[model samples]
Target: MFPQSICAVSMEKTSDQVFQIIALIVLVITSQSQNSCTAKTFTNLTTDESSLLRLKAEITLDPDLTITRNWSSRSSVCSWIGVTCSTRHHRITALNISNMGIYGSIPPQLGNLSFLASLDLSSNYFSGTLPRELSSLRRLKYISLWSNGMKGEIPSWLSLLPKLEYLSLRNNTFIGSIPISISNLTNLYHLDFSNNSLQGKIPQELVGMQRLQHLSIQYNYLSGSIPPALFNISTLRVLAFSVNMLSGRIPNDLCANLPSIERLHLRGNRLSGQIPSNLSRCSQLELLSLRSNSFSGQIPAAVGDLRALQFLDLSDNHLSVYFPTGTLPLSIFDISSLQVLSLQRTNLYGNIPREVGNLTMLISLDLGYNNFTGMKTKGYVIRAFV
Candidate 1:
């Protein structure tokens, strides 16, 4: 061609232009790839598939629930308020819709989320039987449907969940017997069916649940003899069977072997027989209630040995006995943790112990209604005691 120098200069310029074009193409491709990944990671959710969308729609119509519309399905669920997500992704793991005043039956479609662990639908106006479809969520661990107007028997399908640990169906209008299938929930730790219309014998198979720690079936229509197995479970720390129609002799060894017991309530039943002297073995006993039963016996002095005891109620029974005179055990007076002591309506005719003032933490002391007629004089004692 023309001149070697000019050709060389033009070649250099063309090379530079080609390099710039290739660099621009790479930049555009990289930007598009980043945007595509983001779009895929947080796919836009339609109103039909979004539980949050439906919740928001309902909350919008309610004057009481001032929910914000800022909630989006595209955002990480963990970042959303009142939602807990698993570590794997932004899938909702726990939904606490308590006291939301959202009036509607729980949508059966909620079973679509397999990662859900806890569902709290308490203190609302939700009506209708719990959907059987909820049993599809195999990962569910906790379920609370208390303080609602729900009816129907406890769903047997729910007992099939492998991971269910805590269940509360208290304060509902549910009727029928406590399903025997409840024994299948071996992993359950806390089971509360209180304040319902559930009636039937305490299933003996429930004793097989080794993990149960708290069992509250109070204020129900349950009848029959108190299952002996109920007293033998060592894992039980809180046992509330109050306001039921259970009867039988008070097991002498109820808390004798259970070293982990902290609270025991057997009030408002037809339980009879002597107070177990061996109950002092419940070294960890803090709150013990034996009120309003037909128990007729002498109060055991070993009761004063409960060093960890804080609240004791032996009222409304035919207990004809003294405080088992002698100096009250150091655990009773020196513990300084006793708060409530109600011995009213018992047959105690001894002088009121002046050492009762040693309970600085005593908040409520009801010693009236007993045969004792002595009036202890001290303004601090009455002021310190409720």
Candidate 2:
């Protein structure tokens, strides 16, 4: 009986040891699973790191060394220069390296950052065509490649970015016609392709963009009449087509459709025809620059209706007709917000009205090269050529 009791005690000890061994095995499995997850997370981040390293390699010059000195594998990619990461997914979200003087072609591998949203490489020296690989970034929203040396036909694939909104490729060496597919960006707000060597008519298809606010194609080689449909975009605040070869009669109903128009810079174009008298209908008009055009006829009496008018330039035009009484329109001086009023070289024949002094906000007044007489002012300096 004493031997039987000893065997029972030994069996109980063996059972406890088995239970301990099972618990140890379970802990090891759970720990391995947790480590696997951590390793996967790190492996995902390493891809982004590799992509950034490739980009750094393509960048031949970083004038400030901001990218070269900061981007290093010894440190986490999240802390690297110009990179912003998402805290939840641990993925890169934005890369804003604008005005960094980065010189080199953009590495196509950058398209591996599928989670990237905003990419600003403006004011750099990036050259060559945009890589088709960029189309991989389906989540991209804003893109600014302005003021760069990038030369190529603007990629039509840019329209494929589903979430793209603002695109500024202005002041680049991009050649070829503006892509009609850009109109596919229905969500686009501001589209600037200004100051490039791009030629071709402004795509009438762009009128499909209902959300477009600012459309600037100035200082380009664009020719052909302004697309009449562009005026239908009421959301446009600034419509700048200056310094182009655009020719046509200024649409008589110019301001009728542009309710939110603020700055209409049509200067240095070949626009002709009488200045639209309905211009005052654009109640939001602030800067109206019609200089170097062929607009004729008297300044419309409704000009004073633009209470927000700040800068008015009608210089170097064929505006010859004067008011029936042979004097400047009293309405012109009534604009209290007038700051820079330039009517230089416009054919005028009249006595300067005493009402001119009423323009208290006038700063730079140029009335030169006009057939004017009896010009006298009390409070303001005037440059009149009689």
Candidate 3:
């Protein structure tokens, strides 16, 4: 009953309106889908999150534990379990869970954390290969995953983290050679790969880590001469390369250049040659161990100048040296410090200086397997405390 023109105009209007409404519905669905994806990714990070949190909650009562209450109200993860976060939005900066006795594999989802500074999961029972995805944590600074049962080769991709400073993967089952790319970690300060199944020469590339302060690669299957480049690290303070298959003379200038060195352990190896007298140049030296080696020489008298020395072990070798002269520096007698000393199996025939009695601080003194008697016996009384 209506005119054709009127009907046509109404139909056109209706079609345009329907198109607009459909476009609006599509836009809404897209926005919601994106938001849901983000939520699901974060919410279901681990299907076992409840168990993880319940385990960590016990940390609040431990004498060794402390946590910020402010984050406790956030989501379980956003909450402060092992987390350290930024001041503004509380993004995690560190996640130290050392000695927690937490069992199971490390969650690869941890790689999603972009702001983490440190991740310490030491002394746990974690097993399986270390997740290589960890390389995605570009902001990571320190990582300690020692004392576990983790297997497989060390993740070579970790060298990509620009801010990494400290890395310890000691006392694990990791096998294979140290990655040459480790040299790329220029900002590294402390590195320990000790007590693993790592074999082959210490990477010469590691010599490039100039900022490195402490390095320990002991108790592995590492063979070959100690890298001469190691001695060149000017900032090095503590160096432990013991209990390996390492042979050959320790780099000559090793201790000569490390003026700041406080402790040096080169024991339990096939290392040969006289103990470097130049080692006395380590004015800050406190501990020195050269046991179980093939060293044959006189104990350097310059060693007495190491007034800061607290512990010294040259036992289980063929060293021929007499005690330094004088009332063993009064510093050595101070009961407040200087506790242990061992010179066992050294071929020495001398009188025990009476000054040995002055070392009241000595707790364990080993002079067995030697040839000291007479005057040495008197000195032995004062110093036998070690």
lDDT (tens digit, per residue) of candidate 3 on 1-386: 88999999999999999999999999999999999998645533232344245444533333333432422435656555666666774566677767766566765666666666888889877788877767878989899998988899988898899889999999999999999988899999999999999999888889899998899998998888988878888898889988988998876556667888888888888989887766668888888888888888776656666767888787778776555553123334443345677777667556556666776776767766667654434223224311
How good is model 3 by TM-score? 0.76
Q: How accurate is candidate 3 locally (lDDT)?
A: 0.74
Per-prediction CA RMSD (Å):
14.3, 11.5, 7.9
- lDDT assessment of candidate 1: 0.76
Q: What lDDT score belongs to each candidate, Candidate 1 first?
A: 0.76, 0.87, 0.74
Native-to-model Cα distance after best TM-score fit, residue 273 in candidate 2, in Å? 0.7
Cα error, residue 278 of model 1, in Å, equals 0.8
> What is the Cα-based lDDT of residue 252 in candidate 1?
82
Q: By the lDDT metric, which is better: model 2 or model 3?
A: 2
The digit string of per-residue lDDT tens for model 2 on 54-86 reads 999999889999999999999999998889999
State the weakest 10-residue window (summed lDDT) of model 1.
Answer: 377-386
Residue 131 CA displacement from its true place in model 1, Å: 0.4
Q: Candidate 1 versus the native: TM-score?
A: 0.78
Candidate 2 lDDT trough over 10 residues, lowest sum:
377-386
The per-residue C-alpha lDDT of model 3 at residue 243 equals 91
Worst 10 residues of 3 by lDDT: 377-386
Best by TM-score: 2
